[model samples]
Target: MDGRKPTLKSSQKVSLLSSSVRTVIRLRRTTQVLKKGLPSRDSPSKVLQRQQSLGKVKAGNQASFQGSQYFTFDTSAQPPQSIKKKKKRPKNPRVLYPGCSRKYLPTEHKSKAKRCLLLLVGIICFQILNAIENLDDNVMKYELDGLEKTMRREVFGQALAVENVMGLLKDYLATHIHNKPLVISFHGPSGVGKSHIGWLLAKHFRSIIGHEMVLHYFTQHHCPEGVPAMSCQLELSKMVTEMVTQAEVEEKIPLFILDEVESMSPDLLDTLGGFFHTNQTNEFLNAIYVLISNFGAKEVTDVLLQNVTMDLLEAQRTTEHLRTILSPVLSQIHPLWTSAEIVPFVLLEKSHVRSCFYEEMMSEGIYPDPNHIERLVSQLGYYTKGELELAITGCKPVVGKVNLL
Candidate 1:
């Protein structure tokens, strides 16, 4: 006996190799099915059992390995892979400081002026709206359009004067607050509609603003020749204070008309001047004063008569000149006229007097014949200049003349 191991035949070795390859292929297929989560032909435990038995068979069959060592596959049961959880980010992550270990979030800056500016703008807008409302409430109380229409229709041959008066009234009455009372001094010759305008204003104000709110003071009617000047001054002051106080309580502006002011005593003039003073109460300041006078009648007439051809521009210039001339003269009389708005009344032509007669006749319910009106106008005295005859007594005598007709 030589004690040597016997070698297998080539055919037997080939068969053994084929059987091992088939067993390895089956095991690999089973592993792939399990990874894909598909149901395998055998359970995991059964598969493990089968693999163990095959390994045991290969170990027992030592002739298959001959004498060489070969690598063995571990088929032990492995725990199923556990699912890994992802880390979550925090809401406010902190960063380390540049020079320190402390961490903090960046601070945000805001402005308070923006909010304050918005509030300021809102306040300003509110004030403007309030002012506009006040202006509307104050101005709408008077029907200025109606007053203008009345003046245009009733007043004759004083277009410039009427327009100036209306303009002043509009400007003064636009607001209730005034630093000083409005003093309008009407200067012209007698019978040239100065007193007539005063009368019309009084009547209109009485109709619209209540009778108690309007005061018509005539120099002769209120303070006659027998009345003492001091007594007249006291009485005038008392009446004005009462009217103004009542008007203030009612939140209204009163109308004060003084006719024949040229004949008023200096004391009475001074008393009236106190009402138009700047350093007065709000009640006294918020009033309309119309002074009817023949202060510059001769000068006004001479200026109008000299012009001969008075257009709109020429009339405006003449009025300005008259104001300049009359201001000093009136101021010399009393300081009351210093701040007054002097409106010069021009002479009424013969045609204007004829129109006045026609209106008077129609108003009196008498038939207005052209020839009758001409004769009535001719009966009135006139001042002739450059073929232009102006009525000396405007519509003053028209009522009396019409009554006789």
Candidate 2:
């Protein structure tokens, strides 16, 4: 009667739930009977047939499946389609001897391969030649040592000069290919071993390079006394050019020594300047030019005497000092002064003169008698006085005087 729905009794509710459960059971049983009577959608025979059809279809068309986006079965277990592998050809046989030429190689060898092989061989040959050159240099250095020893033994009282000249020669040999020719001008008084040193150098070169490579010209001996300067210049110019040209043709470094260079005409000295220029070939770069002169002898003698008297170190008589004192005098006499390096041979002291006398006596196989040596030393005293003029009784006459004694 009220506007609200009435609640059912417990017994009535239970009976209604049982009726619903019975309805569900009856529907399930009807479904089971229908399933047993009808055919299955995925039966084993149908599934097998479907799989065989899929296998026949191409891999490219497998994407046409309706449910491919949501479900996929693995097909990797299937064997792969037939495929072929490429085969490599074998290399052809060819000659292997070192003496065999490229033309004798197998025709199958590529030009690029042949070029690479030749390049490797050429590199090996070049390395061998380089090693040989180093061996030759070692031999030359040994020879140079012998030369230096001979110089010190032969030239008396000029050990400093000998050492300096050796240094210059060593430097020249080290950079002969690129450096300028070494122009050395030996300046000192007469009979002081200047010319003797030059001769020794020439002799050493002759023993090493050959006699034709060493050229010696005593300016006084070559240019006759009282000859006109112009005629002397022309003759000297021709002689020097011919000598250098011949050395070049023979592939030898020329060794030129102009003894008594102080006597040469100024014009002749000027003509020789061109050979010492920096911009020259290796032929001239390796050349050795020696000018033995008596110019600045007095100045050098004075310096040595002063140093000895003052008890100063012998090292004060340096090359730079000699160059400074001698440069002005040399420039006045010749135009090639700046192109040459001046090396002074100091005036021999009394002890040096005594040593020279003893050396000469021993050379003659004479007994080392103190009395005989004393007499010779006394006779040579006058020459060691640093006199401006050449001594008549200097070392030049000591050998002759020792014989008389």
Candidate 3:
């Protein structure tokens, strides 16, 4: 036996090589089929099981050279969802006024800015209104002070009389006692500062001066000559009612002044009783009524002359005493006098008349020499007239006599 290895022929070697190549290709085809059966990233596990079953069936007739067609995924089956954006809402515009201290904001926040501006404007308007009301109150106080000062400084020989009236007014304003109207009657001779005092009051109260709320009736001019007393009373009542209605509408207190009240018919004067009664609720109940008369002129003159003769001060004749003395005199004229307060307009003495004369001369820009003043004083005739005439007249003529000088 020979000791040598056996060797295959060339044709057999070629056949063997072809079979090995086919085996390798078959193994690769199996692997690719398994890979194709796996589920895609987006597909469910149930789809993987269905694909595996279909691959097994297809494997029996599978072609080995199918390229990459089995590996390609169908992405169009589920497209990526489009992202949606939310829309924003629009805003309102801001309004601005003069003198505002706010900064401007962007248009996007205009609604917020408008609300803030409105709040600010409301606050500012409130402050302005408060300041205006305070200013009005201060102005009213100033006017009242000026009125009091003018009365005390301008009117002479009636300090106590003026002060009493002022006290009544102050009490009325402070306490708001509205039970009835303040009825004051001036009882004294003419030119004794009764009319002048009334004029001062009218001038000071500008709201009522020359206004319909203030009714001044001079008996000499207002009384109709031929009219019957009843007719006159009816007409007066109608006029007063109309004035009172107007005053109530305007929220003002009515002031009625009857000058030369002694000359008025008793029936005409009595017509005011309806308004003066405490139980009455008419708008005129809140009115102030002033009656100027010479009913107690003789009594006032007698008291003053007695005081002068005794060299006594006029202050000794107090308001209470004068009131007691004049009450009976006033009651003689009208029954309404019982309800009214009697304020005596003092008779000006010779000194006060002389002072008035000097003041008149000064106002006229005529500086009087001492001798001229003496002559002016001499011209005044106090005792020449009878007691009745003297008691009825007052220092008013002194100004005319000064003019004559």
Candidate 4:
């Protein structure tokens, strides 16, 4: 009694534990018997061991059990370590080439190419400018404007002829080079100023480019009556060769004028023709040949007389018509005229003769009087058509007439 519970004897405790184990074994045998109706591959001992392990593990982790399978969870177990995604690095362009400091682009090369192109353009521009300046220098040496003004002021009633001659001169003299000699043939009646134009051209050229550079050969004066055509041809050829050769050496264009070519023999004409050809020497090719002839005087006069009243436009047409009519006739006379540039000098009108009289008087240092000029113009014979009167002898006798005054 003292308040303590009654303690069982050791033998009684042992007998009670044995009876409990026997009761458990009996209950397991009964369960096995009951489950024997269904087939089971597991032995009773293994099934009991698995059940025991399941009960211990399921204490802390969530788990599910099916009829034959048992699932278990462990809360203390770590989740599978999350695989960290690796970040990809950007590629470097310099890795493709080692030890090269320049960029992969063609920017520097393209810049160099542009610089070369600009330099080439600058060189081309310089060459063009240089050529233009040289051309200017060649043209400036002639002083052609002064020549044009002098011709216009001195040569009267021949405006068209002056303009045409100036145009041809400017074109030919623009360059010092030539493929062939320029052969300008003046066709007109006597006293219509054919020889006068030739003289003026020779004089002007002589004043500008020395007298040796100009050869004004008068066929009649140079080859007088009864002279042998052969001797005259040889002499003429010698003179021309000397002049042209010397002129070529000096790099100067020479003027060769043959007046009264109507009287020149066939042999002499042929020699002159040889000089005008493209196959000739450089000296001959750089010369200007002016041939003054009265071979077509009758034809030129007849054509002008046919038009009762003429105007500037009609005059141009008449000139072209005269050229067409004269070309075949002159060409038939000599082959030299075939390549000649035919410049037709028309009949001088009565008014032109009057002006000529006045000019002659002034040149002779005599004052001019209108009445005296009219009187001088009246002395000249005219081929009249309506109010247009063309002088028959033109200003041919103006010098003699002024001398008489």
Candidate 5:
């Protein structure tokens, strides 16, 4: 047995070396065998038997990970192979597609598709370039027909002395202001049309540029409950500068809308030296800034006394008083809600209010109580001419009396 061991080893070594060389010519042999003795796809055992008869081990091929073993498959005892069913793709439902919609996902799968290859990676994204080619045959084609239609101005309330104010606003907006900003302010009593004036100016040129509002009450810095609320002038100024920056980055034409300028906490208003002009790419404002407030008006006399000055009547005289009183407080407001006085809009008048209320209501097919409308318009007594016009542009048809204390 010891003497026969060398002979067995020699035979095995020869077989392994010959198999290694034969692997190179196996491709040529496979072609001839396939043409002459290939069995049906089901009879793989027969093919293996024929190869083995030709002195090939037909065992493990290293390339496809076949090691040294061939299945001496017994044909008589061969087991069955379980065939798995492949999942079939769903068929396209035949629909009368006559028009193409951009946002529609079609059910049909077409063999031919449009391809867009982005970066020359040889990979192409496929999509049907055009679908529902005939517009006359479909009604869905009109889905986006009215998208570009112009919107008519909802000039509801009165048209007081607002014409010049509107013109001034348009001109001021058209011309850019660098470091020196004009202080246009709208002052009035509570429930007056200060906010409405701001809204009007915001939408003056159909507001092609969207407006950004820094509302005092809504932002929680100044609450409606008569609490002095926190003065966030510095915070607000920072907010404005930041808005300008973000808008520039996004390439968005956004406006800055600040409401209730007078009620801005005394802490912030005291600091009026805040400056927003900057030379940096992201440091400057690329926005139309509009700051609004009722304190600019004579009616918010209480605010002036408590925060601005002891002699309340003096501060109520003009924007100069408001600006002068806040000079010492300017530093507190930066880098937010800067030093510029609040910009005013065109004022509204009594007749203009009535006309707007009537026209806007009629157009909407809405008829609010004439008495309520009159009562609301009467509040205009405390408003600037521009503000009153904004107030009456139109009263909403909701049932409620707006109590403007």
Candidate 6:
């Protein structure tokens, strides 16, 4: 052996390497193997892509220090997507009925014409008391008598806002008079315009001495036998029909107001439809029937259920969307049974509510703290301006009270 160094055999040299040294050698070998397995770096396009990708990033381009670096993109290269515009909501217009406007707040309609309205309200109250199984005539009279025009309008508006109401109305009408009676279902969410408009039309008709007295106005809430609980629907229906018959034979054509059809069952719907069309069968009761409901056809197809809670003004805004969902409800009714009128129940929305009533409230100093007042006013959020005013002032909201113009 020379003075430089002594050479060992392969096995001996491998054995001489320490554990850490062996690991380093193995890592080097792995690096060489990986390098051989990597894609070729000579491809110009590939090299360019890598460089470009790296160029897209910079250490400065970071959302926060805690997060990893992000790439700065040339967002200007592509224009931002345009956002769809929201539909402009219409303002709250003037209501026609007394208490339909906030203007009558200080002087509620009850104070002006309680005696006259009492008879009309009495008819509704009496029916409702019977429906709720004589909940209490005294209590019913007090509450029913107190219901202003605005309350009816709001409840009717919310009811009308339900989907497929238009189609249902058509169907109900088709099956009833002359095999398509003037009788039709005015189906919608609760507090929609069905009963309200019915009440309005009845009131207007009553205002005039028409051959057909606006005699019987039946609503779901006024179930004389506790029908609101869903268990007593049949009893309620029978009670309603009987009342209509009485109204027709005694006062005028039995104008049966099937209020809150949404609360009734399919059996009730079919039965009512059959009875309305076949009242001619008995030759004793040829009532001019009107079935009102918040149930729409589309609600059947979709698993979701939108409650009948929207106020009058919201109905207008959501009517389109609701209609799509209500297509099925329309299918349930006959085509000819369209609503005599597809009126929006509540004409006033929040913008309208504030504009129509709040300003008036401010002028009158109805309550302290403007902000607080607004907050309290919107607590339920579903009731419309008419309903809200009806509560606040215990009066009906009319078109003249909150004229859109």
- Listed per model in order, the count of residue pairs whose N, CA or C atoms clash below 3 Å is 0, 0, 0, 0, 36, 72
TM-score of each: 0.68, 0.60, 0.59, 0.70, 0.36, 0.34
Q: Ranking under TM-score, best-scoring first?
A: 4, 1, 2, 3, 5, 6
lDDT of 3 by residue, 241-307 (tens): 9977786676556677888787777677778666678886657676778878878887887776554
What global local distance difference test value does model 1 have?
0.86
Error of 2 at 85 (Å): 66
List runs of model 3 lying over 4 Å from the truth.
1-142, 175-177, 207-210, 308-317, 382-393, 403-405
Candidate 2 clashing pairs, residues 3+ apart or interchain:
none
The lDDT per prediction is: 0.86, 0.73, 0.71, 0.84, 0.44, 0.46
**Residue-level lDDT tens digits of model 2 in 1-405:** 878899899999999999999978866764674589643344578657856876778554666664478777666688777887767766895646676554454567467988999999999999999877865684474377888998888787677788888877776664335467778989887778887788888888888878777788887777878888788777766776676677778655678898877676666777777778888765666678998888898887766555543223445445457778889888887657677877888766656667777888888888768777777666554433443222333467677776875
Q: What is the lDDT of candidate 6?
A: 0.46
Candidate 6 Cα outliers beyond 4 Å, as residue runs:
1-179, 187-195, 205-252, 278-287, 297-325, 330-348, 355-373, 378-405
Model 6 alpha-carbon miss at residue 389, Å:
19
Give residue 278's lDDT in candidate 3 (0 to 100): 85
The 10-residue segment of model 5 with minimum total lDDT is: 143-152
Candidate 4 C-alpha lDDT tens digits along 12-75: 9999999999978867775775588543345789769867987888853433343225555565
RMSD from true fold, candidate 3: 17.1
**What are the runs in model 4 whose C-alpha is more than 4 Å off?**
1-129, 308-310
lDDT of 4: 0.84
What is candidate 3's local distance difference test score?
0.71
